[model samples]
Target: MVVEIVQDKEIWDRFIDESPYGLIFHKWEFLKIVEKYSGYTLYPCGVFRGDILIGVFPLYYKRNMAFKAIFSPPPQSGIPYLGFVMSSEYNGLKQDKKEVFLNQVVDEINDYIELASPNYVSISTVSNFIDIRPFKWNNFEVVPNYNYVIHLDEDLDSIWNGFKKNLRKQLSRPEILDLRLVPSEDMSLFYNLAKQRYEEQGLTYPIYSIEYLEDLFRVYPNHLRLYYLYYGDDLLGSITTQEYKRYILWMGNTRIPDNIFGNEYIIWHLIQKAKEEGYLNFEITGANKKNLCQFKTKFNPTLEICYNVCRKDTLGKLAETTYQKFVRKAG
Candidate 1:
């Protein structure tokens, strides 16, 4: 087996499109956007056995005066998870064979890591890529995060019946029903609301700039959806969703107060839209946050755990500890 940098976009994206574990986050175009907006250098690597391509891993390199780091699906890019995109051949392998193949991939990754010699390396694997034991064995720190996924293949009535009573009540409210669900191009409004939300929580706003969002919309128009809840001329809230293989409720911002319950209305509308669109799953990403978990649980979605793997050198470890301490104190 040999691993080398893949420069051909068609080859890279073909593997991603064919893999069951692939996501929109792993697409070549998305990585270009990430690199362009975040100003990070991208390394697109491919592993081949003999002459056949078997795996692809994309890494972003970041450097500062203090440290150098590499991330797979880097932070603040609206990407939930991305690590390795393996071929379908690996997917069908028996457990023992799968382990052997995975180890080979890890070996290649380790070789690249040694050559790059970054202070830190972090990778978040897709939801379906659950065989992260190889990474664990390699001394990477593993952190578990939760996401809520509603299986949308079932009958709509059955799905609706699964919602909590209060959620159902909120969805049924006449005021909510009267609000129009309209497609929106107002990213500035979305950014302002998101900024206000972060300020309200006394935390720094983490979203990318309006320019970045606009560029993302331009690049992946079919994959992205932006919707707003409006009562005639008054905008109440906005929700952004992405459709890859499944529907994902990526981010949302609301101008309406809690008592107004505009969020419930907008979410319900999106859920129904997902059902109509024949998506097999609707994911409410990042159910790890306390308040978010509570709110998303009202829909009776299944809990899915995703993994973030990190490996750091001495300096990187110290930096991580200091960052954690600061966050704890701030919280």
Candidate 2:
């Protein structure tokens, strides 16, 4: 088997769209959207046995000043949370034959990474493929990226049974609550509302700007949607949902009216829309924030961990070791 690094989109489009294994991240259209918005160089590395494309690892190059490597370039997001995406569906389908696929994928990707020559390589949000032992790293950190999902194969009633009792009730409530979910391209309004809510509560605004968001929205089109909540013409809440590959990621939401507006209700509404749009799952994104975790639990979705794998420069390795040694000595 031989691996090839396909930089052209036309070739990748055909492969992803045609592959029986169904690789999502390796799809050319997806890569184009990401590269257009994030400006990350998309490397579509795949393994071919004779004439057939067998396995692929979709990777991007980035750098960070904090982790200077043994060899180097300018810094980037390392493994930007969203970049190292793989097709979970594909991985699941090929699980039994994964060893062969895994070896081919890594061999190709390792070569691709070396050409980029990043001293550090990081990957995250890996799904079931980790069981195949996907990648080996010098240092790694693992943490839960809790996601909420509802089985759409059944009727809404059956799906409701899967949600938390309170959540189901909230979704079914018809108390004439003056809430409205407006779907629109006016993402500026959503950003302003979210920013105000964040500042009012003394929370730092995210690194993303309205322009950046608009750029992202334009690139992904229906793949990512924006919705704002209103109460009798008063903007109450806002949410950004991204339908990446198979998962509908409820990326960010904010309630201007705070607890009085029922943030949970807003989320349930989003999940229902995701269901209506035929999404298989809803990702609540990551965990670590105590308050965030508490809020995520209300939906009653299965919880799973998201890991960060890190590689250190000589200096970073020494510092990390020293820090650990110091903590151990203190203990």
Candidate 3:
């Protein structure tokens, strides 16, 4: 098998869409947007066996004089995960065959990484990507991340019954249940609200700007959306949901001290809506945040584990530590 950088958008996107392990963040257009906004070059690499494709990896590269870095999904892109994903056929292979196929793919990826020789490297894989052994074998530090995913196969009553009592009590109100999480192309509003929330919490904003979001929404209308709830003319809350095989609560809905039920109502509504639309799962992204976990746990979704693989040389380690210790604080 050979690893080659894929230039055709259609071919690259088709593979990602077909893979059960692929995510919206792995799509070609999404990567292009991130590349444009983050000022990093994106390399959509595919592992091919004969004439067939077996694996896909969306990698980002950046250089600053002698220092360089590589990332999948890159940092501060508001993307939870983006690493290599195998083709659908791999999922059907026997256990031994799966290991062999994965080994070959990782070998090629490692070769490419060696050729690039970045000072630092990071790759965060999707929750379903459980076989990260190849990366571990290559001496990449493995870190586990968490997410909450609700299997939509269960009945509405059964799913609701699983929720924490406090969450259920908040959503049980007739007024809250009757309110709708309306979808719209209001990019400015979503960005402003999200940006303000981040500032209020003393955290840096995630996405680049409204233009970045607007482009994504326009390009992938079917995949991403902005949904908001209203109390008369006042905007109670808003959320961005990502739709593919799984309906994901992608972003927004930061706590509004006054509108306590806004987020819970939206989440419950999305769960029922996703199930009704025949989606297999509903993922509440970023379950690692301690403060956010309190809200996410109330829904009682299954805790899912993902992995982040990283490697840095001595110089890279020193630079990162220095930045964390002094430069970041100085800024």
Candidate 4:
């Protein structure tokens, strides 16, 4: 088996397309956009046996005066999870064979990491790719992240029936009927609203530029949808949904305060849209944020836990500890 940097888009994306654990974020174009916007150098590696590609992972190299590290899917990229994408053929492998193949992949990755010699490395894998034992064996600290996903295979009525009473009441409100979901190309509005939300939460604004979002919309128009809720001329809220295998309620921002419940209404509309499109699942991305998790829980979605593997060398670990202390003090 040999591992090398994969420069061919056809080869890289073909494996991702064939893998059930693959995501739209793993696409070559998406990585290119991420690199361009985040100013991170992308290192995409492919593990091959004989002449066949078996596994692929993309790392982003981030450097600053305070730190130098590599991330599978870097911070503030709006990517939920991305790690190794193995070939679908591996899915049919026997348990023992699967373990062997995974170890080989991890060995190759370790080799790459040694050559790069970054201060730290972090990798977050999708929920379906549960075999992270290889990473754990390599001394990486594995942490779990959770997401809320509603299986859409059931009838719409059954799905709606699962919602909490208050959520159902909000969806049935007469005022909700007045709001129209308008699909628009105006990403600047979405960015501004998202920035406002971050500020309201006392957090830093996201690093994504408006140009980057426009590029994403241009590249994957069908996969990315931006909708604004409007009551005639008054804009109430905005949400972005992505259709990549499953429907994801990617990001949302609302001008309406918590008292108004505009977000719940918009999410309900998106859920109905997902059902109409025959999507297998509708995911409300992060189920870890306190208030956000409470809001999503009202929909009665299943909780899916994903894993993030993190590792840092001695000095890197010290630096991380100091950084955390500084952040706590600043907060």
Candidate 5:
């Protein structure tokens, strides 16, 4: 297989859409938006066997006078995973055949890494991409990350019953309080809430723009939305969800009046909505963080693991250590 920058948007997107490992994060439109906001150059790379594309890996490269960095989802993009995804047929192949193709793809990726020689590299592989040995073979370090998932195959009642006792009580609070979960295209309200709350906490949130979200909403109306929690006419809080193969609690699930139990109310309704729409799973991302794991674990959902494969050179190691010290001290 030969690896090169894929230029045809239609071919690349079609392959990604059909791939079992593909997520909305793998799409060209999403990557373009991420590139603009992250200030990284988008590289939609492809591995092709003769005339057919076998895999696509969309990466973001950042270059400056001080350093060069590479990321799949990019830092601060709020994307949980964005790595290479294989073709649909790749999944049906026998184990040996699959590894052969995967090995070649990883080799090509390594070749590119060698040529570019970025100081640091990180790739958060999608949940379905289980084989990390190929990447590990190339000297990448594997770090485990977690995401909380609610399997929605069963009926809503069964799903509700599976929640912890305290969670059931929390879910019931909304019914008595007269709060409404209204779905809307109001990206402005959600963005304002997120931006203001982060500022109030003395945190900087420059990862996304209103235009970036607006563009995403415009491009994928069916796949992304904002659900506002309203007490009569007053907005208590809001959340954003992304619907692809799985329904993802994408952002804005916090900074609400904690006393009202608004997060529990809105997210419960969203889970029901996702199940009704035939989604097989609801993913409450950010479980890797201690603060989030405590709150998200209340639902009694299954904990899932994903790999963050990373590598750094000598200078990169020093830079990363310095960056980590600054972050830890600040926290």
Candidate 6:
């Protein structure tokens, strides 16, 4: 197939929108934001048989600033997630013939990379445990990404029963708190509070900047929102929601202490809001392996495993191995 890059948004959006099995990442809105914010460069190559598009590989180029001066322009950051969205099932290419199309698409991408001579390329959140071919690009590296998910399909009564005693009491005593779940217009408050807590704990806040949140608000106001748990004038907690077809991902959350705001109450209210919006599932950003898993089980949502796909050089791999060995020996 002769591949061509699509420059027109309308055509691309129409094609992906009509697809049966689609992911939010493949949607035009997401690509537009990534393109707008990152602005490295967009190489959206389409595999077409004559006039019809069969597959597309979207990628962006970025300089490796950490290793700057060591290599010119360095390696490109990555495509974010081009491979997962390639199948015809997700992009209106051809559903029944997905395997054949996928293989062809992968080969074409590899060939394209070689021809273009990009220093490095990678994809993220491609779960190695559940994906079809976890690491199709033998040359890249792989990392495991864990995301905490709360199952919501089960009856609420059954879910309520599973919560820890204290959490259950908190939910039962919701009337005790004067907290209101209000749609927040100002994200700066939440960002500053979250940043402050992170600084106090000597940690980096793991999230996009306030500017990106504002951009998302402007772009997808209906599908995404910033909700706050407010006690009169004080903002107790805030959460960012990413609404997709079947699930509402709790992208981020921040809270202050004193228990006056009720952290659990904020979560419960978010759940109620998601239900009201007709979402089937809610995801809590994952923490560690044990406590988070146990905590999320109270919600009774199905466990959805998330993974990170990484690409490491030979020396980097060796360094990782040595670090792991040192930790094990220390233990």
Candidate 1 lDDT over 187-291, as tens digits, reads: 888888887787787665665678888888778888887887887678787888888788998888777866667877777778888899888988888877897
Model 2 misplacement above 4 A? 17-40, 62-96, 115-117, 126-128, 137-144, 168-176, 195-209, 244-247, 256-261, 315-331
Q: Which pairs clash in the backbone of model 3?
A: none
Give per-residue CA lDDT, model 5, range 154-186, as digits (tens): 998899998889889877765437788888887
- Give each prediction's root-mean-square deviation over alpha carbons: 2.4, 6.2, 2.1, 2.4, 2.4, 6.1
- Residue-pair clashes per candidate, as listed? 0, 4, 0, 0, 0, 5
If scored against the real structure, what TM-score would every candidate get? 0.92, 0.73, 0.93, 0.91, 0.91, 0.74
By how many angstroms RMSD does model 6 differ from the true structure? 6.1
On residues 212-260, what C-alpha lDDT tens digit does candidate 2 reach at each position? 6676667667676787777777766676665654454554555454434
Which has the greatest lDDT?
A: 3
Which sections of candidate 5 miss by over 4 Å?
174-177, 257-259, 321-331
- Give RMSD (Å) of candidate 2 vs. truth: 6.2
How do the residues 289-322 of candidate 6 rate in per-residue lDDT, one tens digit apiece?
7865675666554555544444445544554476
* Residue-level lDDT for 296 in candidate 5: 83
Candidate 3 per-residue C-alpha lDDT over 1-331 given as tens digits, one digit per residue, 9 for 90 to 100: 9999999989988898898888888888889999999889998999999889899999999998998899997776888888998899999999999999999999899899889889999899988678899998998999999999999888999999999997888887666755667889988888888877777765657677789889989999988988888755567778898898899888775554444577788888889889999998999988788997988899998998899999999878987797666543422
Off by over 4 Å in 4: 63-67, 257-260, 318-331
- When summed lDDT is taken over every stretch of 10 residues in candidate 2, the lowest stretch is 70-79
Cα deviation of 226, candidate 2, in Å: 0.5
* lDDT values for all models: 0.83, 0.55, 0.86, 0.84, 0.82, 0.57
